[model samples]
Target: MNRLQKLTALDTRFFYWCNDLHRDLGLAPVSRFVSRLGDGVLYLLVGLGFALWEREQGVIFLQVGLMAFALELPLYLILKNTIRRDRPCDRLSGFRAVIKPSDKFSFPSGHAAAAFLFATIMSAFYPPLAPFVFILAGLIGLSRVLLGVHYPSDIAAGALLGVCSAVVALHLWELI
Candidate 1:
């Protein structure tokens, strides 16, 4: 197989490996919950909490976080629509995702992007929360793979996109 084909094969193998863990361990429920958390609500709540309770730092975080998401959303939408890569569950026969995906294409997982964006912005403002937020961001990405709604590469791309967006936002806001 060519390099691209080999990468695709690896992605499929990794997906099955994660799926086996999800199935063998009965982790669907937990995966669903974690995935749901990455659905943008938590990010809003985090921003709101900071804005309402944290004073100046909170306001700055809110602004930077909002900017990061604003940048990420359009890029994410464009890439997903342009690439139009099929989800593993959609492409692979005899496989159905544990939960319905939010959209059709899955080149870059929106959930993973948003989660990592939130984690990056949160870490920039509240350094103490870095470990927890980054860990949660990673879990959100893993949850997408476990639920079979996204390929591992999709998650990786989304994560890289997210971190880049946040870094840009931070720089724009003069916070980094």
Candidate 2:
């Protein structure tokens, strides 16, 4: 098999194991709740709340949220269109995905990206909360894999991208 095929094959097995573990741990409800909280509306409200509570922190939240979307959305769109990786649910031999994926492509998970981006941004603002946010993000990322909606590599890349985006945004904010 080619490199990409090998990668996907590995991911398929990894995700299957994760799915089993999640099922064993009874993570369905928790995953669903976390996923719901990851939506744009909740993120906006949370950022606004932070902004209201602490003006400077609120600004950082707004900036980070905007920057994350600015970086992630376009990349998701482009890669989804270009890579067009099929969702595991669609494949007959693939793991039976718990969640219904909207699109066919499943290269880099938007959920994973958003989770890490928010965690990274929030950590920057409140260093004390770094561990909590990262742990949350890590759980969110694993949820995607557990649900069979994303490969482990997909989450990893998304996280890396998120970290890069957050760093860039912070540097840019510092300049302005």
Candidate 3:
């Protein structure tokens, strides 16, 4: 088989393994909570809070966040539409996701992308929170898989996209 095909096969197996563990551990409730955190509301609030209440650094963070999301969202939409990959829930036979996905296609999961994007921004603005935010971002990605809506590779792609977006935003903000 070709390399892409082999990768898909392995990804499917890994997905199943994660789903199995999720089922065995009864982690659906926790997964749902974690996944929901990546839905954008919290990020917006945090950014706004920083901009309104915090000092100059907070304002800078909010600005950088806005720039990052502006970049990430467009890129995410283009990639999702271009790739048009089916989610595990849609593609797998006799398997359904624990939660309904926000969008139709799933490649480079938006949740993972948003989570990591915020994580990267937060880390850049407040280096002290790097470990916590990154860990939480990772959990958000893991929650997508545990809930059976995304493959690990999707999360990885999203992570790369997010980190890159944030990096670009940071550089742009520096120029301002």
Candidate 4:
């Protein structure tokens, strides 16, 4: 087998292990909750709430929210379509996923990307909260892999993409 085939085989085996763990824990509801919390809608609402409660902190929250959305959109809509990586559940025979995924490529998980992007952006604004935010992002990323929707590599790439996007956004913000 070629390199790509070998990777796929490995991913398939990993997915089975993930699937077994997911079934053992019966963590469907919790995973769904985490995934939803990592979504843009919650971020927007949280940003708005922060803005209302603490004016200065709210501004930072809003900026981070905007940066996250801006970064996520291109990756979700444009780059994913261009790259077209298949989800583990879709490609692997024994793959099992409790929660259904949307019609998006799985190379770089949107949830992972969004979670990390928000984590990094929030960390820049509130250093103390950085560890918590990063932990949350890491859980969300792991959930993607554990739920059989993504490979370990996919989550890693998504995290890298998120960090890069946040850095670029912060730099541009500084310039402006």
Against the true structure, what is each candidate's TM-score?
0.98, 0.88, 0.98, 0.88
- Model 1 residue 106 CA deviation in Å: 0.5
Off by over 4 Å in 1: none
- Candidate 3 lDDT over 1-176, as tens digits, reads 99999999999999999999999999999999999998999999999998888878888899899999999999999999999999999999999999988888989889889999999999988899999999999999999999999999999999999999999999998898
- Regions of model 2 farther than 4 Å from truth: 1-5, 92-94
What value of lDDT does candidate 2 attain over all alpha carbons? 0.78
Where does candidate 4 have its weakest 10-residue lDDT segment? 71-80
Query: Residues 47-90, candidate 4, lDDT per residue (tens digit)?
Result: 78888988987786687669756866686566677889888778
Candidate 1 lDDT over 1-176, as tens digits, reads 89999999999999999999899999999999999999888889879998999889899889899899999999999999999999999999999999888889999999889989999999988899999999999999999999999999999999999999999999998845
The model with the greatest lDDT is: 3
Model 2 C-alpha lDDT per residue in residues 63-91, reported as the tens digit of each score? 77787679877877787788777777776
Task: Provide the overall lDDT of each model, using Cα atoms, as 2-decimal numbers.
Answer: 0.93, 0.78, 0.94, 0.79
Q: Give the distance in Å from residue 168's predicted Cα in candidate 2 to where it truly belongs.
A: 1.3
- Candidate 3 stretches greater than 4 Å from native: none
Off by over 4 Å in 4: 1-6
Identify the superior model by lDDT, candidate 2 or candidate 3.
3
Clashing pairs in model 1, backbone N/Cα/C closer than 3 A: none
